[model samples]
Target: MTRRIVEILKKGQPEETITIQGWVRTKREQKGFAFIEVNDGSSMSGLQAILNADLPDYETILKNLNTGASVEVEGILAPSPGKGQRIELQASSVKVYGDADPNTYPLQKKRHSFEFLRTIAHLRSRTNTLGAVMRVRNACATAIHKFFQDKGFIWVHTPIITANDCEGAGELFTVTNLDLNNTPKKEDKSAIDFEQDFFGRRAYLTVSGQLQAEVMAMAFQNVYTFGPTFRAENSNTSRHLAEFWMVEPEMAFCDIVGDRDLAEEFLKYIFKYVLETCPEDMEFFNKRIDNSVLATADNIINNEFERISYTEAIDLLVKSNKKFEFPVEWGLDLQSEHERYLAEELFKKPVIVTDYPVGIKAFYMRLNDDNKTVAAMDVLAPKIGEIIGGSQREERLDVLETRMKDLDIPPEELWWYLDLRRYGTVPHAGFGLGFERVVQFMTGMANIRDVIPFPRAPLSAEF
Candidate 1:
């Protein structure tokens, strides 16, 4: 029989019979009846079922039922006058499919640690916290697609397996299907024996889809990629994940300023959208995670982000008198501490730090007129440091060639990338927004692992 949700049941629905399926959350005893709290997968809040003493299995169901049990109940809707809740179910029959033994079920009525939840990744989703996170994640993803589609942007799918490294960092998870016991020896440790490998060439999972999206943008003018990006960095921090979703938007004729503007607007749109669509879940997070959740949302809608050059950000960091683990320097990459200080202490909000030193940035950043800094911007949020990083790509063929050479990147690896400049190239720019990081910020979740459903990290793919 088809089951109905408790939330959908209205008061005074006179004697309508239906079936309900869910895990039993609570059970209460009464003189003539028992109220069984059952929650379907729809939500955490369960519905009350008043089982009459006349039913043959009422006593058995009540005695056998535990906090978490898979069951189906055939019942009729009735008006509930006991509390603020409007309706209750009057059960006629109960069938137990699975019983959650209290001795084994990790999740009891009380709260559990986020770190502890990671051990039981398979069952974590059923918990109230993870369920709320996944729901908001769904809403945020939908908002991203809607925001781009409404603005006439085409969705581009970039390859997951790539021939070259996108980040230029040697961190890559190599792919091979050859026999490990009899693997061929390579001078450089690359999987060069194409005869045995699956792809027939030195290929690995893509670290980012930026370069391929650039190809699409050259023709489509404006495009975005929403896909998985694998990074093989072994740093065991809460922020780093082996595989994560990256939202990258590339525009054919846009410059650094254009990229910054779009990045700000795009983030604001998602933040606003989630707040509007997932109010109940966000409310749950706000009460459980952070008390300023509602106020933060309201302020985000009304506030304009602050922008400053990377030089200015460093200067602010120096003046703050904060003892940083990594000392601030002119040419050094902005550490997380520096980013947090600029966003929290100096600007006291979301801050855009642009024009980083060319030597410290990636190879694709457009070299500025001064030749010392690159046309780039990083959107640093108050609590979470650098959430977004992007820049106007080097469009000038000669300058790009020089930068690539200086960075020790071979021109042949980026054949099609250079071909864009050789043929029909316009000023293009884009940025990568860490999808898990956004969820963490919005939900006030402490770790990146807690936000994503199945987090991929080094040597830990057990889910």
Candidate 2:
């Protein structure tokens, strides 16, 4: 049986026969023997295999064992005489499945820029940085499921295609089956007749799953949605993606206080879990990628996140005596720079800012007693600004109806949502977290595109 490199590295005894199937990362030929490093994508470090001249078909096998080639090697584990690695594989036999030409392969034995890696995303995962990123990303995802499941939170599968504009941002990607070349038009030939298209009405790729999560929470009491969300915004920044994954968890009979507690606990749990699960990868990131990687993780795991009201945050920003490109005011939304300053510079830890202005938040956020601000909260982290955004939902029927009307949102389109409050309303709250943003934070990667396997962004969807 073929053994994983990670398991062998951890528990394989010396002189034990083993078989490893993976792609060749590098090869160094000598007068009497050859050395090749093979990675199975199970860990950051690859297994170094030594092949002697007396091995069967040595020249033929050597010809095919270039970088990026796939092969299966039967070897005996032995203590390594070289530095860095603890053990090395003494190969008795080798079988090559495919050959990669060293001259044409995009990934050489040297460092490549993230921009060039983005272009070759198909093969970037084989590199050290991307591979480490992917490992950390997987650890994060597993931690998410484990954390939610441990608390009796049901994994709710929300729809990717939704009709309602959850954020009211108007950055939706319309989903229509109507022929663009010869679309069905209205009687006056003004707008495309969406009624004649699929779904019998206009629909869009969901920008968020918060509303749908609320519906499930009403039934399940506690539920979470982890799925893909899309936005048609033309943002070309490192922080924005046209298509990304979001984690939204809604809980019935919960208020803003409970929401804040859960968000803080959730973040701490994920950080601890990832560090425990992927120490080697985390160490690699700390030593090579960003020197502060381990320190940031330690800070999050050990410290208590600071909590402040949005009003107080605004006041602090105003009194800081620091110049900001965007003006800090009470009613205006906080910019990334402002968030970073509060979390990275001032607090030096994760900061939870709550009770945002109603005009700046979504219509579903519970209107505060003052009627000016909503019970919304944002969890801002160092380096990355807003990692999680959530709010206590408006459960009062009259208030929800009035807020929807004030925002000019069509009541008919969200009839089901209004029905939740009209029939059996309960105080509930939830938050939406960008999965990619969290991965980027954990790895200290400069670009959001580098964290995810295949990133979909403006004018770039090759893979």
TM-score of each: 0.93, 0.98
CA shift at 10, candidate 2, in angstroms? Answer: 1.1
Which structure among the candidates has the greatest TM-score?
2
Minimum summed lDDT over a 10-residue window in model 2 is located at 161-170
The reply for model 1, stretches above 4 Å from the true place, is: 1-18, 186-195
Encode model 1's per-residue lDDT on 176-209: one tens digit a residue.
7878787875767774465557776778889889
Q: Which residue pairs overlap in candidate 1's backbone?
A: none
Write candidate 2's Cα lDDT for 416-452 as tens digits. 9999998789999999899999998898998899998
